[model samples]
Every structure is written in C-alpha cells, then in structure tokens.
Target: MQKRYRIKREKEFQEVFAAGHSKANRNFVVYQIKKPGQTHYRVGISVGKKVGHTAVCRNQIKRYIRQSLLELSDQLPGDVDFLVIARANAKNLDMKETKTNLIHVLKLSQLLLEAQAE
Candidate 1:
C-alpha cells in the first residue's frame, strides 16, 4: 500500500477509531470513516497486544494487510479512509486469507464501491 495512506500516530488511530463506523465479522473488525476530499484513502493497520506481543508477528500481520490494500488500491473509493483493526483471528491467517477477509469486510462496510468491486 502507499505509505501516505498508512495511519501512524496514536492520535490519528484514536481519531479513526472515534470517527469510524464499526462492524465485526468472522475474520476482522472494520473501522471506516469517510474523507470527502482525499483523492485516495489512508489505511491504518492496528495489531494490538491482544493479537500478539512480538514485533515480527505484528509486522507479519500488517504486511499481509498492507499487501492486500496495495493490490486493491486501484479499487478503493476516492473519498474514504479505512482503519483495519486486527482481531485475534487475524494473527495466524496467511496472506491470501488475510487479504480476502479484509476485502470482504471492506466491501461489506461499503468502502469498496461498485466501480471497484471485483
């Protein structure tokens, strides 16, 4: 995924969490907030302590999320930011599963518009 779209700050994460509409599915929890003016979305990856404690584990999960977002980057709506908050289930999933699950939730949340739907 584009580096510009990654949510990093503690405050920004908090804001996305606060600003977004949330939903929980079998695979993940999605937090979505609309950004009307942004030409592209900013996605934040959060793998909290409950998921794993090691950096490698967290990075692996995030890498899976990022790679999925990168593949679907061209498909995203122009005016939305997505925050993918990882659950315990996300910790062990392989990249393909991770990507599919994330995309599924994103579509369910209506972040991926019809123009972008695959």
Candidate 2:
C-alpha cells in the first residue's frame, strides 16, 4: 500500500479508535470513520505481539492484509478511514484465508462493496 493511502500516525489511529464505528469477526476488528472531502479511503493495520510471536510473523500478517486491501481498494468507500486490527486467530492463516477473513469482517463493517456480476 502507498503511504498516501495508509494511516500511519499514532494520533490518527487514536482518533479513529476514539470516534470510529467498529465491527469484527473471529479474526479481525475493523474501525471505520468518515472523513469528509477526502478523495480516497485510507487504512491502518495492526497486528500485535499477541497475534504473532515475532516481528517477521507480524509483518507477514500485515503483508497479507495489505494485499487484501489492495485487491479490494476499488470497492471501498472513498471518504472513509479504516483501521484493521488482527486477532490471534489470524496468525496461522495463509494469504487466501487472510483475504477471506478480511472480507467477512469488512462486510460486517459495511466497508466492502458488493462485487458486481459482469
């Protein structure tokens, strides 16, 4: 993901946590807040020590999430900020599983647009 499309500051994450609406499934928690006048959506990802024992594991999880978000970017709302926090159950998932779990959570949060049949 690009830096412009990511929420990278502690203050930004805290603001989202404080004011955003949240939804979750077994593997992920999604916090969403609308940002007026924003041209595109931004995302913040968090995979903590509890979810992964080492930095490599955590980074892998993050990579999976970033890839999923990239694939879904066109379907996401342009004026929203999303924060995705991974649960411990996410540690063992492969890329496909991660994307599936993320889609479930995003649907719950109403962040994902339905895919159009062409």
Candidate 3:
C-alpha cells in the first residue's frame, strides 16, 4: 500500500482507536470512522506480540491482512480511516483463511461497498 493510503503515525492510530466505531470476530478487530472531506481510505494494521512470539509470525499476519485490504480497496468506502487489530488466533490462520476472515469482518461492519447478498 502507498504511504498516502496507510496510516503510519502514532497519533493517527490513537485517533482511530479513540473515536472510530469497532467490530470484531475471533481473529480480528476492525475500527473505522467516516470523515466527510477525505477522498480515500487510510488503513493501519496492528499485530502485536500477544498474537505471536516471533517477528516473522507477526509480519506474515500483517502481510496477509494487507493483501486482503489491497484486493478490496477499490470497493471500500473512500472517506474512512480503518484500523485492523489482529487477535492471537490470527497467527494460526493461513493466507486464504486470513483473507476470508478479514473480508468477513469488513462485511459485518458494513465497510465493504460492493459486498454481495448471501
């Protein structure tokens, strides 16, 4: 993801955590706030040591979540800031499951613009 589309600063994460509405499944938590003037979505991913003891494990989880978001970016709402927090069970999932679970969470939160009816 490009710098403009990624939320990199500490304060930005805090702002999202403080004000964004959130929803969660077993492996992930998503926080989002809609800002009126913004023209694109900015996302932050957080995978902590609690989720995995090794850096590689944490990074792999981050990569999977990022890939999922990237795939759905075009259909996601533009004026929102999203923060994705991975839970410990996330470390146990493979790439495909990660993407499916992430998309499921997005759908539950009503964040997926083109989400289809079941």
Candidate 4:
C-alpha cells in the first residue's frame, strides 16, 4: 500500500476511533470519518491481537486487507477517511472473499460511491 493512502499517525487514529461512527457486519467493522478535503482519502486497517496472537497470522490478515483496499482505493471518495477493522474471521479469509465482504459493508454503510454487487 502507498504511504500517502494510509492513516499513519496515532492521534489521527484515535480521533477516528473515538469520534467516527461505525457499522459492523459479519467479517469486518467499518469506521468512517468525513473530513472536508480536496485530496486523498486516508484509510487504515486494524486487526486486533485478540484476533490472532501470532505475528505471522496477524500479518497475513493485514496483508489481505491491505491488498483488497489497494484495488479499490481509487474509487473511494476524496473527502472521507475510512478505517477498516478486521475481525477474527479475517485471519482465515481469502483475498477475494475479504474484498467482496468489505465492499458489501461499505455499500450497506452508504460510505462508498460505487454500487456493490456482492
């Protein structure tokens, strides 16, 4: 994932977690904050340690989420900051499945502009 696309700062993450509203489905939790902006949609994916204790497992899930996001990043609106939080199910899910599920959640939450078929 590109550095500019990610929400890297601790303070930014905290503000999103605390002030942003979220909607959860079976596979992922979507937290979104709308910042009036002209460029870039800041995004972050968080998979909790409770989901998996091992580093390999956690990294794999993060990798899957990151890859999925990279594919759809261009379609995301510029003024919104999105945080995708993976659940325990993320550890075992495949790239295609995660992407399908994430797109579904994004649509249901009315966050994404494009239509979701899955």
TM-score for all models, in order of appearance: 0.88, 0.96, 0.95, 0.91
* Ten contiguous residues minimizing lDDT sum, candidate 3: 109-118
For model 4, give the RMSD to the true fold.
Answer: 1.5
Q: Can you rank all candidates by lDDT, best first?
A: 2, 3, 4, 1
Candidate 1: lDDT of 46?
Answer: 80
Q: Candidate 1: where is the Cα deviation over 4 Å?
A: 115-118
After superposition, candidate 2 runs with Cα above 4 Å error: 116-118
Comparing 1 with 4 on TM-score, the higher-scoring candidate is 4
Over 4 Å off, model 4:
none
The whole-model lDDT of each prediction reads 0.81, 0.93, 0.92, 0.83
lDDT of each residue in 50-105, candidate 4, tens digit only = 88899888888888888877787766888878788888877778889888888888
lDDT of 1 by residue, 3-109 (tens): 68777888878887888899777768888788788887888888888898899998999889888888887778778766888898888799888987887888788
Report the lDDT tens digits of candidate 3 across residue range 20-96.
99999999999999888999999999999999999999999999998888888888999999999999999999988
State candidate 2's TM-score.
Answer: 0.96
Better of 1 and 4 by lDDT: 4
> By TM-score, who's the top model here?
2
Comparing 1 and 3 by lDDT, which wins? 3
Q: Highest lDDT, which number?
A: 2
Number of clashing residue pairs, candidate 2: 0
Per-candidate count of clashing residue pairs (backbone under 3 Å): 0, 0, 0, 0
Error in Å for residue 110 of model 2: 0.6
